[model samples]
Target: MGRHSRKGPKSSGPDIEAATADAGADREAVRPVPGTGRRRRSVEAPAGSDGHTPFQQTGHVRGGHPEQREPGGGWGTGLQQLHRGDDHRPGARPTAQQQAAAGRQQSTGTRPLVPGPRREFVDAFDAPPAPPAPPAPRGPSIPPPRPADPSTSVGERDEQPPGGGTDGPAPAKDGKGAKGRTFTGIAAAAVTTVLAVVVAGQVTQDNGGGTTSAQPSGVDRLGPDGASRSDDRPTPEPVRAKPLSYAQKMAKAYPLAPELKASGKFEAVPGTAKAPGRGHRYRYRIDVEKGLGLDAALFARAVQETLNDDRSWAHDGAMTFERVSTDDPDFVITLASPGTTGEWCMKSGLDTTEDNVSCDSAATERVMINAYRWAQGSSTFGPDKLFAYRQMLINHEVGHRLGHDHVSCGTRGALAPVMQQQTKSLNIDGIKCRPNAWVYPPS
Candidate 1:
């Protein structure tokens, strides 16, 4: 069988050699197209059985050729010989060096022995090239254009409510017509027209005035300064008022007991100030009684607490309440009912004695104020006024003790000196003094 198979392919020799030579010639003749700069794949011999005999050779078109061959004994046949190098023989094992080299190649992402490029004959007769992509269409340039304006009138342009509108004062209405329909329409129109005329006139006047030089109101030029022009009106020397220290400021506000320096009391120990006897160093003995007279005591306590809590008052060491007493105490704090008498007092009636009856700065050195009249709303003045009066009276008597005399209201809206009799009536009589309206020196 082997002998017959070997001999069987002798007739196919000339044809196979001719095919092989043709394939080689085809490869040698292959060339790249001009300007493409790309090389074509070349054709090469197809390995097979029959020991490379030219007589056993075969030929095929690039894409249409069958891939398999017949078994061992025939020309260009035998699948076993076709894939000879790819399969392992029985129990063949890789050498240590070979295995190590393969592992190294894998680790480094590299390999050897890739097949050479296709032969020239294959390149010349390979599959047709892929179709080229289509070209893009050309378009015209469009330059940006101006925005379309809807209307010419500024009012219409801005979509404002009619006639040459403005944000300021409303146009006055014409009072010439009656109060109904046509009157309103006509009046509105007339008013709008008048406003238009006035506005036009003002604009024209302004434009005209810009052309003329007006007389300078000062030694300086009417134009902006820096031209070295002097003003006839005394350039009031910019008297930058010296800023008072926090203490000075508080003292200026409540001069009776100028702001005191902070004692270590509040900060000494956490609860030290609030401690029973230790904290109660300043005992506030409120003289509670029936009648309007006692009301002053309550109000005084409120004032006392307000002053105590006042950060400004506390931080400054000018004064601190050791204790609050009613009468014959270090500081006698007396009160005035709806009707009370004596030198130090607060009442609607005009009475001045050893225990005065009006809320005023008496020469005496103890505090007297109205409690009932101030609370019951029947005071001749407002609570604020009564408060001020009471405050003044108290501070004033204290002032006498401190050696201060009667002083007037010097500031425009500043808190008036405790000695001042700023209230119209000694008692609350007219518009109550607003709490927020403090007295200050007139500018």
Candidate 2:
């Protein structure tokens, strides 16, 4: 190539001849630099045929000349080719020559000095349609099922039977196996139900009712011999007799032989009864002979209660009687057998053997009351008036000890005095006085 002149063009004929001569001179002046062995050329931005500078064509200043340039003009063409695809036509394959040239360009680190044939532009719509993509390969079809092996166990088998089917030999269509299992299960359940019912019934019977009775903890459920005592029936409570009332006790009569003699030894009745009134108090002791087989306590209580009665010697608060167990007393009221009474009465110079009567043994500190008379009512005051007769006996004997003498009723049907010896004759001299127990009987 020849270097173009930077001067303005002159007349056409002369300019052509001068340019030819300058081209020849430039060719001669071009020489290789020492050591590089390559021609060094000064590149200038010459005006193009269109009258545009190289800078105007490429939008950049051109320095020294490159070894080659694209024929169409500026270095911009070389840059475009470097970036452009090797195959200019769509869907066109690269030729062997183009491939070899690309390989050399890559090796030599340079662009092709000579451009290839000019690429003709083709419209995308006018180009041939791409071959339809081959249909996707069809998926492998399912294989046929194989028969199951009898020798293999269910777990070791390659494929399991559907619906978790059993591998064992199927039961016979006769239904014997199913029927036998169902019958066995039914029998077991029935037996269990019967056993539960039987146990409940036994427990109910043992407990005697639906509710169990709690046993007393102190009571031993087992016998001394280590045998289980029968608890099927509740033990019956022991029967206890009701106690006798005071009226019933006073109404009852006690038995004693009129002539029976008892041991003369005496035992002082124990315990004291306080005088219940603020009056002239008289203290007495009650002594019961041994072997009397009498209720000494009852006798002593009767003596104290009767003597302190409002209607007796204690009437109008004239006196109150207190029973004492001490030796010192106003008098000793003695309850003895008829014989003992007779012996004690004799000491006072009185004879009670004939009537088995009670007397105040003044010679001694004892007022003897015949146990026979104390136990049996007198004929004058018969069994119907036995309670009153017993009271009269106590008052009479005690009255005598109080220095009272026998007195008879002056009027018939009038009550006899407590000191009237009512036990012997309430109807003295045919006056027929009603029997009385109180010294001051109720009007």
Candidate 3:
């Protein structure tokens, strides 16, 4: 339909071999511009009875005329479906990229032309880059696999770093070990301290670079391997305790002290030969709380002079101790008051109201201490170093009533570690000791 007739030139009337056999006698019929009646039609690229040239039957043209040969590298099926729509028909005339894809389908009106996004076979310049995801299968283990002894202390080396550092040991992780259990239940609750949170509940000291301070008493607290005293001098840096407590950290559970007492009945304290025959003798008891003004016989004579003294927790002879009032005592050192030390240290699962902190329960053998860290003692025993914060609160709640477990003073200024938490910060983990209440102090 090459619109032409101003009613005249198609050779002056019509029938040029019936309009060239209705415009398809293999197309090419266009001879009308002599006066301007116009006619231009085209078609060609046909000849394949083996006379070649559909770009010489696909091997890149040789003897001309497949659209004058020249496009041999990309695209072909004879130049995509033979030059698709040489000017697309049915009243054509659009391009300028189909009037910008018709002004984005008339500003996205029912939206449908989309078709352009396919390119990423590795953005094909010849394609081939996509093969790297296969490495995860090692199994069979326990808590011994990571031990080249860089001072092995895990549970993120009891984490108190910054100013009270402990270097970095954290690798013993199992189900949820550390204060909770499982790297062989934190090495079997680090040798007996399976889980006890408020036997006294709290205290602190950090010097590596953070804040919190307070550090006193060293004139003699025990452990030159196990115990022997003559007030061996040099123990002087005393007087820093109390500072840390910006407060506000609660929630894991709190509230207690509806009333309590008993720093009376439990007595007898005398025994030790350092591992004497070696380890296990337990039995204990001591109380206080009735409104907590403190001093139940100076907190039962600083826990019978820090457990018959061989540097406490019966160090060496494997263990031993005895001080009873018999509520079936194997442990019970009470002294409550930060709200009954969060009610007898949440019966051992341990929780909040940290009035400075102290907790121990190995299932309620009860150690709950905190009358605010047995009356003003932490900042890592800094102030009156209440005889080394009552020998680091009776060797950290009798090393969690003998089952043990919290350690980390393996290095820094050394010492500090009657199961380190040194009341709260002692480089919690970045490693930085020195105020140790024994586990082996003296030296």
Best by lDDT: 2
TM-score of 3: 0.19
Show where candidate 3 strays beyond 4 Å. 1-280, 285-312, 321-325, 328-331, 339-368, 371-412, 417-438, 441-443
Could you give candidate 2's per-residue lDDT for residues 244-278 as a string of tens digits? 87556666788888889998999999999999988
lDDT by residue (260-344, candidate 3, tens digit) is: 3333232323332222234666666676656454446555655665676676666566666656665676667777666656766
In TM-score terms, candidate 1 sits at: 0.26
Residue-level lDDT of model 1, residues 104-174, one tens digit each, is: 43345443222333344356558687688786556322233344333222322332223322222112233
Worst 10 residues of 1 by lDDT: 264-273
* Predicted candidate 3, C-alpha RMSD: 36.7
Task: Give Cα distance to truth, residue 341, candidate 1, Å.
Answer: 3.5
What local lDDT does model 3 show for residue 179? Answer: 40
lDDT of 1 at 81: 18
Reference-based TM-score of each model: 0.26, 0.48, 0.19
Where model 1 places Cα greater than 4 Å from the true spot, the runs are 1-285, 288-290, 293-297, 306-315, 324-328, 343-366, 376-397, 411-415, 425-443
Against the hidden true structure, what lDDT does model 1 obtain?
0.34
